[model samples]
Target: MFTATPSHNGYSKTQSLLHESFWLDNPERPSAKSPVNQDIEVDLVVIGAGFTGLWSALEAAIENPNWKIVVLEGDRIACGATGRNGGFVSASLTHGFSNGLSRWPEEMTELLRMGSQNLEEMGDRISQLDIKCDWLVSGEIDVATQEYQADELQQVHSEMNKLGVSAQYFTAEEIRARIDSPIYQGALFDPQVAVVDPARLAWGLARELERMGVKIFEHSKVIELQDSGTLVRAKVGAHWVSGRLVVLATNAYPPLLKRLKHLIVPVYDYVLVTEPLTSEQRKSIGWLNREGVGDSGNQFHYYRITEDGRILFGGYDAHYHGKAGVKPEFDTDPDSFARLADHFVQTFPQLAEVNFTHGWGGAIDTCSRFSAFWGKAHGGKTVYVAGFTGLGVGASRFAALTSLDLLQGRETPRTKLRMVRTKPLPFPPEPFRSWVIAWTTKSLQKADRENGKRNLWLRLLDSLGLGFDS
Candidate 1:
C-alpha cells in the first residue's frame, strides 16, 4: 500500500486560475433566449432547463408532435450542476450495484436492465442528433487506496460476477500500470460508465429542442406556482404563463413545492481542472485509455482527462451549509480547492510542477438514499423529480422519462419500479438536521481513517437505512 504525509498547506499557483467552470467557458455556448415577457399558454411547461428538464421537453415533444412545449430556466442553460460536475456519466440508476442491492434487492435486476438501456439510447441520441460534445465511452475505474477498500472491491468484483455484470479486478501493480498513481492499492474496472463534455451536451440538447419547435426562455425565474383548476399557472416576473401540465426539474435549488424542502439538501461539491499536459508530462503518466478514475473511500475523489488533455479532479469534501440554500457565494471555496490540490499532488507526485487552470463548485441535490426519487404535486398535474445526489449526468435522462411517465399517467415498466415509486426519507428540520449531518460527516471521515470500521452512530444510521453522503 502507498502512504504519504498529509498537510494543510495551500497552493499559490491555483490563485491565478479562473473561478468559472472549464466546460462552460467555451466560446461555442449559444446565446441566451429572451425571458418570458407576456402571458402565454402551452401544453407543457417544464421548470429548470438543466439536463432533466431539457430531456423531458424533448421526449414529450417527440411523443406528441403537435403539443406546444415551453421551458423556463432561472439562469442560462447548463449554468447549474449540469455545467459544474466531474462529468462522469454512470449507467447505474441507483447510484451503483451495491447501493441498489442494499436498498432494492428484489427490483435490482430490472433496474439494471433499464439503466443499461438508458445509456445505450443516450449514445444513439447523441449520434442521431450529430452533437459534437467530446463523447467518450471509455468506462471508469474505481481504485482502492487502502487495504480495507481493496478487500471491499474484491468482494464487489465477486458479487458482480455472480450477478453477470461485466467487471475486472486489477492488482496494485496492474492498476499502477494503467494510471501510474501511487495512491492506488487495487482497482475495480467497470466498462459501462462514460465521460463527456457536460456543458456541450446540455447546450446541444437545448439547440435540438429549439429545432423541434419547443420554446425556451432564460433568465426567467418562476416566483410562484399556482393551480388554476383548469391548468397550472406560473408567475415569472410580470408574466403569467399557464400550462396543462408541468414538470419540475429544479434540483438543489429551492423547490417551488414546500414538501421538497425536506427531501433535498444542497451539498456543495468543488472541482479543479489542470492545464493541458505537455507530451513529456503526459508520457510520465500512462493513462492510455483515458478512463475516468475514482478512489474508493467514504470521501472519495473522481478524476478524468478532458478531451483537451486537462485533468478534472473533484469530490472529497461535501459541505452542507447551515440553512441549506443555493447561492452564487457558495460557488468558490478556497479551502476546499487547496485540499484538492494537496491531494492531487499526493496521488501523482511526478506532476508536482503542474498547475490547475480552473476551480469551481456547485450544489448537488442530496438525499438520504443517495438516488433520484419521484413525486407529484398540485393534485398530480405537476410532476417533479429530484434527489440525484452527485450522480445525475446519465441518470438524469432516466429521471426525465420517469417524470414524463408520471405526468401522462402512464404505467410503463420504468414507472412501475420501486425505485421510481418511492421517495427518500425526509431530512429533519434545521439545527437537528445540521447536527446530524455534521456528526455523520465526522463519523465517515473516522471510518475512512480507521480501516472502514463503522462506529456506533454510523452503524445505527446504516441499520435504520438513513445516513448522509455525496
Candidate 2:
C-alpha cells in the first residue's frame, strides 16, 4: 500500500531493505548505532538521522549536554538522501533569489544568503573535523537545455551579477569545451559550489555527533507521537518515550510523520552511476571531472562526476509516482535514464559500453514552489523541516537551524524564508495516478526534447497534478 518499493537490487524500498545500496551501505555509519532498546526518556527527541537530525542532535548537545538528546532513525544514519544526494555544497540555496522573491519577499533574500554562507561554513567544519568526504572546491554548471530556459537563465545571470554571487554564462562552445555534452546552449558557473562525498560527509557528521555524547538509536522507527502532560512522547515499537521537544527531520519520508504527511508529496528520483572511467575516457570528455552539473529541462536533471571518475546522473522528471503509490520500470525504468545515458555517451563518444553499474532511486519532497518548508509545531516543541525539492544538500544545515528556531520560539535564519503552500493534486489513488504520472513523464520528456523546456500550459497541467494535498 506504501510507495517504498525498492527500485534497485530487486528489492522493495518499503520492505526495509533501504540500506543495502544506499551510500551508508558502502561505508559503515560513522558511529556504532545501537538498536532500539527499552523505553528511554530524554530532554529532546529528534526523528530521522539524516543531515538535519544529526545536526539537530549536535546543536542540542552543544546547547546543553545535560539535556539528554535522543536521535532516532528509521534506517542507518545518512542512509536517506543525505547520503544519496549530488553532494553539491552549493554556497547558495536551491531556489534562486528571483525564484524566492517570486514566492516570498526579501524575507528569504538575506536568509537564503545566510544559507549559502552556512554551506561554506559546513565545509569548513568538515575540514576542521578532518572528515574525509572527498570534498572539492569546484564550481557548478547550471546549463540551459532550451531556448526559453536559456532566456530565463539570462535573467539569472543578470541577477547573479547584480547580487555579486559570481556567476558566468558560457556559450555553447564554451560549455562544449568544458565537457563533451552538446545538449546545452549555455551554463551558469558559480565558484561557490563544491562537490563532496555526500554519504561520507553525512556519516562523518553522525559519528561526530555521537562522539559529542549525543544518543543515537537505529531501528528506532518512531511510529507515533504523544503529548504528555509535561512532555512530548514518541512511540517506538511497544515503548513510548517522553521528551520536552521533538524534531521531525524526515525529508522525503514525511509520510511516516503522520501530521506532515499531507504537507509533502513523496516523488521518486532515480540515479545511475557509471563505471570508473579510464584516463583516456576522462580526458576525452574534458569534464575536468570537477564541476557539479545539471540542465534546465522542464523536469530538471542534475549530474556530476564522482571522486572515482564515475558519473552520477539522476533527476525526478520521469518517475511514475502517485500521491500514495508508485509504479516504476524494473530495468532502465521509464526509459528516461537509458535515453539520458545514450545522450551522455553521444556527447562524449570516448566512453563506449557505458553501462550504469549502479542505479538507484529515492523519494524527494516537492512543494508547489519547490521551496523548503520549515517550521515549529505542536505547541512550540515539535519542530520540523522538509520540502527541499531535490536541493537540500547544502541548505539542510540551515534548515535544521530553522527548525530549531521554531522549536525554541526564537528568531532564526530559517524563519526569514517563505514558500507558498500548494495543495497536492487531488487524484484518487490507482490506475489514474499511474496514468497521470506516466502521461506527465511522456509529456515532459517530449517537451524537453522539443524545446528543452515544457510548454507553459503543459507545465500548468503537470503542476496541477503535483504537490501535497493540504
Candidate 3:
C-alpha cells in the first residue's frame, strides 16, 4: 500500500486543537496512545479506539479490576469523529417523538426519556471525574430558516406535549431577541444538551481506563474475530490478542463482521474552527455565552462557540469513500474547507468574511433510522455497537453502558429501542447505493422543508414515504 501518501482518509494533525491558536488544548490524562508493536492478552478486547471503545474498556476494567481489557485503535487516539466532531452532546429526541414512535415500534417516549438521562449522566461523569473537556452545559437551539421549518417545530412541539416531554418553544420574536437574524422563523430549545472537547474527553477516559488496569494497545486493529465460545483472537501490528470476550466498538471503519458491511452508512461530517473573534465582535453575535446550535431543515448546519472566542461550524458534505461513506477529502482542499467557511459567514452576517483557522472531517455511522444499531455478532460471543446515525456523542455514551449491561447478561434501555434494526437502505451496493444515498438525502431535505412549511401537500409526501423514510 502507498503509505507514502499517508493514510489518505486520515485526520489532518496540522488542523487539530494540538495546533490551533488561542485556544487549543488537555485530554483526560490518557496514557500515550502512540505505543508501537507489542503483544498482550486480556479478558476483554475492545476494537476501534474512539469514545465507545475507550469508555467500554474503562467501564469493564473498573467493574472487574482483575480482568485485562485492551483497546485496539487503527489510527491515533481521537483521530476519528471523537476528535473531529462539532462537539455537541446531542440527544436522540432530535428525530422527534412522532418519528421515533413510528419508526421504533416500542417505548419511543421512554427511549427518548432515557436518551436525556444519558446526557445527564455524561454531565455527572465529567463533573465527578473532573475530566476537563471544556464541558459547557447549555441549550441547543434548532431554528427554522424557512416558514416550513417553523411549522415542523410547531407540530413537533404539539407531539412533545402529547408525549409529556418537557421543552421550550420560542416565537420568531423571541429568536430575533436572542440573535439578530431574519432567516429564522421560530425555534425550539432543548436544554438537555451541551458541547465538549471530544478529544480531551476521549484521551482522559483512555488514561483513566489504563490507570484502572486496562491494557491499551495503540496500533491495534482487530483484523478478525474468532467465534470460539467467548474467546476471540484479534490482530495488532505484531500481536494476536486473544481474550475471553470481544467488544467490537468499531463504528465507521470497515466492519469486523461481514453482516455489518452494508448495515452502517458512513456519512462524512465536516467541521471548521475560526480564529478567535474580538471581544466586541463576540458580543455582537449574542451567542457570546457559547450555546451550540443546529438549523431546523432536512439538511442543516451546526455551530458552537469554543472556550476561546472562535466559532466551530459544519454540516453535510459529500461522502465518496464506500457504499455508505464519503470518499476521503483532504483538509487543505479548498472545495471542502472554503465551502464550509462560506456557510459559516453567510449564516452570521456579523462575522462575515472571518477566516477559519482549522478544517477537518471524519466519517460517522448512520442507519436508515438515524439511530444506532447494536446486537450479537458471531453467535453471541462477540458484541458490537454501531450505526450511531450522526448523533454519536450521547449515543456512544449510552452504547458503552449498554455493551457492559449485555456483557453482564442484563437488559438495557436499548431493549426498549430494540425495534430499530439495521436494514439495507432499499438497495444493495453499486447503483443501489448511489441512488439510495442521493434520493434519501434529497427526500429527507424536501420532507424537512415540507414539515417546516406545515404544508398539507408536504405532509402528504412524508405520509406516503415519498420524500423521507416512514
Pick the TM-score winner: 1
Best candidate (score: lDDT): 1
Residue-wise lDDT of candidate 1 within 1-470, one digit each (tens)? 21223344445756777999999999998987899989999999999999999999989998989999999999999899999988899999988889888999898888888888999999899989998988899999999999889999999999889878899999999999988988789999999998999999999999999999999999999999999997999999999889999999999999999999999899999999999998888888899888999998889999999999988999998999978389899999887888888888888888888999999999999999999999998888899999989999999999999999899899999999999889989999998999999999999988888999999999999998887878
Angstrom error of the Cα, residue 322, model 1: value is 1.8
Off by over 4 Å in 1: 1-9
In Å, residue 280's CA in model 1 sits off its true spot by 1.2
TM for candidate 1 is 0.98
Clashing pairs in 1: none
Determine which window of 10 residues in candidate 1 has minimal summed lDDT.
1-10
The residue-level lDDT of candidate 3 at 226 comes to: 68
Off by over 4 Å in 2: 1-22, 25-32, 254-257, 323-337, 419-443, 452-470
User: Model 3 — which ten-residue stretch has the worst lDDT?
Assistant: 1-10
List runs of model 3 lying over 4 Å from the truth: 1-38, 93-98, 323-333, 420-427, 442-470
lDDT of each: 0.91, 0.67, 0.67
Model 2 has an lDDT value of 0.67
Error of 2 at 318 (Å): 3.6
Give a tens-digit lDDT track for model 2, residues 164-233.
Answer: 6678998878888988765667777877778888888877787777788777888888888877767888
